[model samples]
Target: MAMSKQQRAAVVAILVAGLLGGAAILFTGKGGGSGEAGHEHGEHAEQGEHVDHDDHDHGHAHDKPAATPASAAAAAAAPAQAADQPHVIKLTPEQVQQAGIGIATAGSAPLRGSVDFPGEIRFNDDRTAHVVPRVAGVAQAVPANLGEQVARGQVLAVIASTALAEQRSELLAAQRREALARATYAREKTLWQEKISAEQDYQQARTALEEAQIAVQNARQKLVAIGAAESAGKDGKDGKGGSLNQFALRAPFDGIIVEKHLSLGEAVKEDASVFTISDLSSVWAEFVVSARDLDQVRVGETVRIRSTASESQAEGKVSYVGALLGEQTRTAKARVTLANPGMAWRPGLFVTVSVLGAATQVPVTVAADAVQQVDGSSAVFVAVPGGFAVQPVKTGRSGGKLVEITEGLQAGARYAAANSFILKSELGKASAGHEH
Candidate 1:
């Protein structure tokens, strides 16, 4: 297979060119395949990224609906729980007895319409007195003490009065002169009858006797005006050692001595008040009525007086009502006279006067004690399955033993009529525990 040099060279050149062309084609095909594969892989990666983003958005959308139902379920369950767990107080039968709890059914009843006014107990002015010394004197002895019960004409105190003494002295002197005059008149008459003396002399003696008798009478009247006791002496003279200065201050009527100003050996004036006595067997309940209610508080109207300090009540009639209104309060004064047999009604005690009006029927009425306060509203405790539940109410007129329920209560409902405050206390304790 030896050939010439030119032919061999030509063949080698052709072979080298062919080999170079094949290498170029193979390199171009491999480069094109790698570029196409890289482009396809990039497209797939972008598409996968878009698909992952869509799945994340879809998951968020599903989560929103799911969360709504959970919240709705929780809200729905809240009301059911509230319905089951109302404010309740459980008590056994023994506990109820120990607590003195009582229950009664609410029903229709008639309530008396009434108007209440604040009042106070005061002394009956008709039976009160202020004792004064009639003459200037020194208090020798004080026999009546403050708060001592005294009878009419009872000696309250003894006073040594010079003015009274002078009056008595003048009476005694005049009486002596009167006795002498009487004797002289009798003697003059006998002389004139017997002709033992001149008629002119007898007449003069008679005139003198008459003048002396008038003077004695005048002096006796002066003593009587001064409240001086009648003398025991034969000639209208004091027999007890002429102690005319001793003046006894006596009570004017049966009463209790409420005040005393005179003390032993103290000088008092002629018009000085020495004692204050009051007959406390009865008292006046004085009340202030507004101008709007003045027409209702007429004299002679019957009223019920209840004490605010204690559970005491009395009945009386209106004795007085002031015609004029007070300037400061714009109210009129009214009073009721009540008999105080045991003296239990003391002055200065606060009271309420209830004047009854017409009565009216109410749909639902409960005992006054059954009403209690809950959450700043009037409420009544109603019997329930487990215990008692508080029922808020609106109240209207109240009188005697019943109160009208305007709302929040129904007829024939059983409720705690007595000792209802126990339930209130128990409910308050439970509420406090939950808060803590």
Candidate 2:
């Protein structure tokens, strides 16, 4: 099993000659066939998939050539270059298409970026009203129910109050006094003109008439203040009996009643919020913006409002932006006025508001899905000989479906725009194999 010194010297000489030959090939690789040099290069590597398999298996020194200084340098440089090289996923163009990976050419596009904010659907305050009974009374009849729609002048409820009866009686008495004074003043003026009475008596009667007229006017005005009519029913005669104390409460405008606190025969206060009515034709999409992004959102800008509860989407303009932020939230409140013609945007519904910005054209861009995370870097799978190469890219502005690439890719370069995660998955598998 052991060789003599003469045989050992011959084997060493053969190894030394092989080393020199391999080094010449490595040094002149540019001029030689690359396929042959690649195989020869494999023979020189010390570790990782390039071990000298033939010599180790045969237990013979001559099975592989010796490695020289030039070959050593070249072999060491191969892996280092590979470490920095773009990962290549070997797949034919047909395979890429068959796998449902969408290919897109990176190019110029108009990018309209948007800032998103969480929001909620709210009642349009201008169209919302908290209905209150302006006069204290007992609710005799409540016709309007919660969530019922009512028109302007529609009777919402009927109330009975003894105060109303007293006020009406005062008005009637004032009118009677005014009428009596008017008759007396006329009689005194005629008597004065004919010298049948003293001028002082006529003047006194005129003053009494003026005071009575003022009292009648004051009583009528007091009834108007409480939303009561000066007279009851069409006959113009005051109500039969209890009708004088009855007050009919009417809706101020056409809207749906959202809340109701009054019930039949319930005693109510003068300032009780008996009902809440809101017009559903329009609503507010309220949102809060951070201080840093306050400059981006402004009045008159358009925004797309979407709801999470359903597939409801609508467009509206920024109607209001608060000048100050909340002390606890540190966020400025903003609202968009959305026309809810179908009443789809209900109050308390969650929504997302995407405030649109002005559009600008950029030189290089790709579909948003084309970009992926590659070793903490943004990269795209670019078209290569077999399939695609992981091309590192610096992303700039992003809009609807495209992202601006400021670097690492050029215009007209095709790349995987969809299902590119397949390529990333392949790269992961390759990495795991190498580690193992």
Cα error of candidate 1 at position 108, Å: 3.2
Model 2 residue 143 lDDT?
A: 80
Whose lDDT is greatest here?
Answer: 2
Angstrom error of the Cα, residue 248, model 1: value is: 1.5
Worst 10 residues of 2 by lDDT: 233-242
**Which candidate has the top score in TM-score?**
1
Score candidate 2 by lDDT. 0.87
lDDT of each: 0.85, 0.87
Q: Give lDDT tens digits, candidate 2, residues 1-436.
A: 9999999999999999999999988878766677677778676654544345655666776756878999999999989866744387889868887899998899999988789999999999999988777778999888889999899978888888778878989999999999999999999999999999999999999999999999999999999887877765511222344377788787889999989999999999988999888998999999999999999999999898889988777888999999998999999999999999888989999999999999999999999888999999999999888778889999998775789999999999999999999999988887776655
